[model samples]
Target chain A: MSTPALDATLAPAAGAADAATPGTARARTTAGLRGWAVRLGSLAVVVALWQWLTATDARVGLRFDRLPSPTEVAAEFGRQLGTGVYYLDLAQSMIRILTGFALAAVAGIALGVLVARSRWIGDLLLPPIEVVRPIPAIALVPIAILVFPTDEQGIVFITFAAAFFPIMVSTRHAVRALPTLWEDAVRTMGGGRAHVLWNVVLPGTLPGVFGGLSVGMGVAWICVISAEMISGEFGVGYRTWHAYTVVDYPAVLVGMASIGVLGWVTSASIELLGRRLTRWLPRGEGSAR
Target chain B: MSAPAAEAARVDAGLAIRLEGVSLGYGPHAVLDDLNLDIAPGEILVIVGPSGSGKSTVLRAIAGLLTPRAGRVLAEGVPVTGPSPDRAMVFQDDALLPWRTVRRNVELPLRIRGVPKRERRTAAESWIARVGLAGCEDRLPRELSGGMRQRVQLARSLAGTPRAVLMDEPFGALDAQTRGEMQRLLLDVLRDTLATVVFVTHDVDEALLLADRVVVLGRGGIGCVLSVPDPRTPDIDRAGLRARIIEEL
Candidate 1:
């Protein structure tokens, strides 16, 4: 690897990096690729084992034989991809989740900031929130049903309930954790309370708020599907439950697969957005490892 | 003769600060009792003391971040009810806004004071350059070393041209090598602004190196005030002065 040249050589950076040092930028990229390969390989192995167990009708510790085989589920997935109802269900579930999440995020942040800022607001608001926070969002399903006129609104409310607390709690903690020195610095600059809120409080709480957002998003997904199973008419969870009643195991598996894929995509986006917003955070040592 | 009178003997273009019977404590933990002190305009007054001696408490009182339980803290002939643009503070920790770039952090005071955007940029950039961070204005606070961050902070404190700069151990966190560089940098920058500086530190050497007058405070109250003959002049025989300050502490 003595074939090194300066950055002035204009050689491709990847090749130069690979040649210069073994554990630098190029090594990290290769390591990342290897990580992805391992993950995919592990997933494939799980699928293969499941197929073998179901195909052979093995009466193991668990009831693997009763479940649809991988090929049957794959074929069901292919059929679902061709249908308009499947697409409609996918879009419906997505819309409800997004609307609820957006509403929760807005309210959570405003209330979180308010509660963190003033003792009066904290005392006035915190008691009710604290009492309500202990109960799971899924438990709100019964209340959501009686309060809303439609199943759609009921499910959406449950989703909103699921997401709200994590965002609010995280944002509150973040605001509280801010060093008093930053506030002192701003105040000494002739800045009033509004100035500190705008300049210091808002941007400083972003990382914490994002942490709450990520957690809220995951919880929202969990409860939204559960609410759909209980009260929904058109979304994926309802459709999946509908398949299970008729004993179409392959369609049920397909529905589960769709939910898994959707959950992964949404959570990944939230995490990616968090990283983008907090680019200033030190990416800590040996992150690749 | 009193040190403040000697220090205030030559004054110009800076804020005159006088603490009249300033007694401060949080309820039962009485920090200072009827502490009467005067800091002359354009004077570099260094307050030296041990931990818990209320060295920082005094600076906070002047910056108006903390309210005095008793008496008045007057700046520029006006009572300091709260923090103002005339009295900016530099904290020991890099209080540079983590999210903003070096230039943006420096521009903050101007922005707060409602200065025009164009003027804010010019002032911020000049200060950033003056602090020898010319090409790194776009970098975030976390990206810079501790010394560089303090330099940014120094630039930030001096920006917007405040009448008085209240520094609470602004260089206390830096390494010895960086501390010396920052001291030199502060003196070089101090020449440009006539802001009355009330600096707080525990280091005896630091107190004599930068102060026209030094105030030593203890758990009870101010121990003594020393007037230096030509502050920051390296050739002066400051051994007696240093010995006196150490003895008082």
Candidate 2:
């Protein structure tokens, strides 16, 4: 009934500590470091289990043979890095994914805002999006190849197709879900429609839009890989497919590791950007988790 | 403050708000019918009634958030069309943007009005300090307690410098002590400004504590308007006012 009283009581203790000395800041930093160490220790245990499975002779149909050990994959990565072809392929793959992702983000957000604000646009465009959204991005590979002249264009198209729907749908939902009072508040303050869109509606929808972008990036990676494996001249996905054809299981594992790391880095970058843009957002671990 | 000037600007002037033969309905069912009331300028008018007594609807009509099927709403002799800068509302939920710091939240109306940045920031900072959030200007709304957030909301509405303020159970979500402090703060703020206030509340004590004239609504129209014999002050007896309102109810 009176949580403010409890908070008021606790506030003084924190204020006292803050005023006492600067050492409290260092102490908090070290405590955060300790938390990170615990998380890393658990990750090490998982790596140890993987190593043990690979070192032992497993009798399953495709245990260590098909799924190469971490060490084996690492060695393959080292050799590939020395040749520098792997880096080139990695760069090409990243460019394709990023370019397609950027295009999707722009187009999706624009269309989403349009549909959310106007009923006529929503009626005209929403049905087509809903009808096609359920069809997998991978399934678009064949269609992309038929529609585009080159393999590169086809793969990029597939990646774009993968990311666009999620971002669009999420943006639309976010726009619609904004509190009606916010718009009224802006209007009362003499803001026009354009001003409201730029200042209030866009900022209000960022959290949800970024949520969609994160998911879209993950799916974009999947589709990019599948598209490359099907028809790419040279890419991580193509190399992985080639390794499988030649029975080079270690090389295949290395490719999978490369894809995973790339996906993680890209997604994390987008998340960081989101946080920077929404700096006014309240502190909570719920969004990150 | 000069009582002569205050009376000339408030009591001596005609009604600031007039709702005449107002009827409102949603599709089929009428919520308010044949309602009429007049609130003097610079007066704190509290509307108290049962759950579905259209107390809030009257405020909504005045704010132009809702339209009445019949009759008219006027503010300062001008017909109310929609939400305007002349009237500001403090919602029940505080409604401070979670992403904005206290200072930024208070500056929202100014920013929308395209007020110069330096002037807006100074105004916002002054109000932040006014509401007792001086040291926490950079803190987000989530970082503040419920009472602090509500204080920020009040500061935001005040920053606009509207002719009148509409508060729809603004302290209804707060605890008893916090609510009391807020009521006192509201009185303090009202004393310093000429903004006419239309407060809607179900709490009899709250109605008595903050209002100069308490208007009770029964089914649709005004049941009664009780003028407090004593002017609003920090030391008013809540128990005495509550007994008076309960008897009327």
Candidate 3:
């Protein structure tokens, strides 16, 4: 990523020097393409090995009935895609994740800034946050169900719990990590406290807050899946649990694959948005994709 | 000597800045002690000292970034309680908002002052061209070299058109060649504007090259205030000025 940007920046100057130098640009493009091909090939090799093991007598116990072959999983996925159930589950999972993630991001950042900036608030609130952060969000499922009347609210709460701590911690750390000079610069420029917080402190904390968001999103998926397994009537997690009860190993594998793909796509989207928001940061290229 | 005498003198001369018995410290450590200085209109005073000599603290006090424990700071007969737009500061690090382009960075003070957009843009453009950043108006600070960034910072300070400018080692981070070029550029700009400037630097040659009056800060209080005889003229004997400053140091 850094190389591409550097190449782009130097390209105009390099072009002026030698218009006939096609070899250099071609070499870089080919190297990038080759890297991608290697990654794809490695993935294909893993699937082939899995298929070979499933076909052999070595596929026993957990491998025999509980786990499905790659071919079987793919066929089940294709079938589910045709029936439109896969898309529905995918959309449902996304809505839950996004709703929870957005809420966590908004609340976490605000609270994080408040705590980092104010000594009184930080002293009062930080201890509870630290204590609660260590407990797994999945463990709160039972308690959430007891408190909330509906299953959806409880599941969303679990997702929120999973994502909130990471974002808050990241935001607080980002705020703290800012150089005192940044604040001094603004203050000396005749900026008020509100102006300093809005302009300098907020922008400086964004990169770190996004880092927290990424970690929180991953955890949200884990807890969301666990929540669905316990009480959800719908979603990929629910479908996967249902498949497990019926001994439909291929469907279970399909569900797992769907979750993985959804998680990757959603996380990538968040990261992309983060890059756009922090386009001014010097180290932006690494996080752009 | 006496409070009434100092007040009467300031009223008569129209003092732009007056620091009376100012002392600054952090917890138990005293950085500056019992310092007195007066800056009149159109006066270009350069503070010279070694590292940890509290030259920066003096600038900070004037800029209202630091509050002195023992004395008062007055700007135009009014007490400087906090940072005000009347006195603009240029920091050593350039402190241009990395996200903003050169033009935007230079225009920030005017924007904060609630100047209309079209007027601010015109003002910003002129200052950008003045600082030799005419072609790089749309370029961000990160895209510019160290010297260019400092130039942008200088443009920003001048665009505000403040009553006084406080510059804290503004060219300290640049390479020797760039630093020399910047020093020359600053002198040219100041000569044209006639803006009262309080510049702080450790380099003896720099103080000699730019200042109308060089204040060598030793220990705490002002060591000496050596007036440069012929700074308004374009041609100056660089060697003679350096020798004079070296002797003072």
TM-score of each: 0.91, 0.83, 0.90
**Backbone clashes under 3 angstroms, per model:** 0, 1, 0
lDDT of 2 by residue, A91-177 (tens): 989999998999999999999999999999999998988898999999987789799999999999999999999999999999999
What's model 2's lDDT at A62? Answer: 56
lDDT of 3 at A81: 88
Q: Write the per-residue lDDT of candidate 3 for residues B15-134, one digit (tens) a residue.
A: 289998888877788888888888878788999988788999999899898888888898887888998776888999948887678888888888777789999999999999988888
Candidate 3 lDDT score at position A126: 92
lDDT for A275 in candidate 2 is 70
Per-residue accuracy of model 2 over B41-73 as CA lDDT, tens digit each: 888899998888888788888888788899999
User: What is candidate 1's DockQ?
Assistant: 0.72
After superposing candidate 3, which stretches have Cα over 4 Å from the reference? Answer: A1-20, A60-66, A283-289, B1-15, B232-248
- Model 1 misses residue B161 by how many Å? 1.5
Residue-wise C-alpha lDDT for candidate 3, range A1-289, written one tens digit per residue? 2345445555665554445677776775678679878978999999988887776735454465335789888888889989877778777778888888889989899889989999999999999998898999999988999999999999899999999999999999999998777677667667788878976899878889999999999999998888889998889999999999998989999999889988888787777778678777776442322
Best-fitting candidate, scored by DockQ: 1
Give the TM-score (vs. native) of candidate 2: 0.83
lDDT of each: 0.88, 0.83, 0.83
* Ranking according to TM-score, highest score first: 1, 3, 2
For candidate 3, the TM-score is 0.90
Q: Model 1 segments beyond 4 Å from truth?
A: A1-19, A22-34, A286-289, B1-12
**Which candidate model has the greater DockQ, 2 or 3?**
3
